[model samples]
Target: MHDRGRGHERRPVTQHVVVRWKAGLPRGRDEPWFLMTDLERPARRISEPYARRMSIEELFRDAKTRRNGFALRAVRLKKADRIDRLLPIVTLAYILLVGHVRLARRTWTPGRWCSNNRPNECSDFTIGPALLDQARFKPAAALAAIRKATEEVGEEWG
Candidate 1:
C-alpha cells in the first residue's frame, strides 16, 4: 500500500480499500478515505465500524482539549490506583458535559456567540466549546440552561 506522502516507501498490506467521501465544503474537492484492514468482513460492515470509531476518536479529542483536560492531566499522575479511581469520575463528567451540550443546542439560540461555522450541524463536540465561550461553565447554570431548553421543547428532564 502507498501512503499519501510523496516519496514514501510502499508497504505491503492485506487489503487497500477506498470509501466515497461524504461531508465537506460545498465546492471543495476531497479524496476518499483510504482504509487498510485485515478483517474478512464485507465492505458495508467495515464502513459502519470505521465511521463509529472515527466519531469516538473525535469525542476523545474534544474531551481532552475542549471539554476538560482529561488526557493532559491523566498523563501527569504517577499512581495507577489514582488513575483507576479518576477514570470513572472523568467519564461521568464527560457524559454530563456532552448531555448538557446536547440539551443546550436544542434549548439555546446560536445568537451572536456561536463558535461553529454551521450551528445547525453542531454536535456535542462543537457545542462544548461554544458553551464554554458563552460562560456557561458552572454546573448549576448549565443544568438550568438544560432545564430551560427541555421546557422549550416541551420535554421534562427526569
Candidate 2:
C-alpha cells in the first residue's frame, strides 16, 4: 500500500508481515489480534516480539484503566520527579493487587460467569474488591512489601 496524500514527509513503508495472533490462548476463545511489523524477519519469529510488546501494552492498560485496574490515569502529577516517584508507588500497588488475585483464588469465592472456577479468568480487576475488603487485615506486611519494592529508589525520610 502507498500513501501520497498525508504522511508524505515520512519515509516509505515497505511490505510488512501481518498476522492474526490469538492472544487469549489456553482458552482460544477471544478475538484474533492483528499485528503488523517491518522487522524484515521470518514470519515465525515475528510473534515473539509482538508477544512481548502486547505484554507491555497490557501492563500499561492495567495501570491506567479505571474499570479494570489501578485507575492511575485519573491521577495528575505534573512534575517529572513526582511522576517518577508515583510510578514506583503505583507499580507496587498494582503488584499487590495482582498478588491478591492469587491468594483470593484459593480462599475467596468469585461470582459465577456462566462457568466454573477458572484461575485463568482471574485478574487484577477481580482482585481490586478483595484488596479493599481485606485492606485492614495486615498493614505491617503490606508496608514491608511496599518498602522492599521501593528500596532501590533511594528515597530516605525521618
The TM-scores of all predictions, comma-separated, are 0.52, 0.48
Per residue, candidate 2 scores C-alpha lDDT tens digits across 30-140 of 655555776787665766666557656777787778876678879887899999998888766666665445444545555432144544454555556645755443544
Model 1 score (lDDT): 0.61
Superposed model 2: Cα runs more than 4 Å off: 1-28, 31-55, 108-116, 134-158
Where does candidate 1 stray beyond 4 Å? Answer: 1-18, 23-30, 36-46, 65-69, 73-75, 108-126, 132-158
Please report, as a residue range, the 10-residue window in candidate 2 with the lowest summed lDDT: 111-120
Worst 10 residues of 1 by lDDT: 66-75
Q: lDDT per residue, candidate 1, 39-156, as tens digits?
A: 7776666676676677678767765773434464436777889879888987767666765676566666665335445454544656565576554556765566666655775642
RMSD in order of candidates: 10.0, 8.6
Model 2: number of clashes? 0
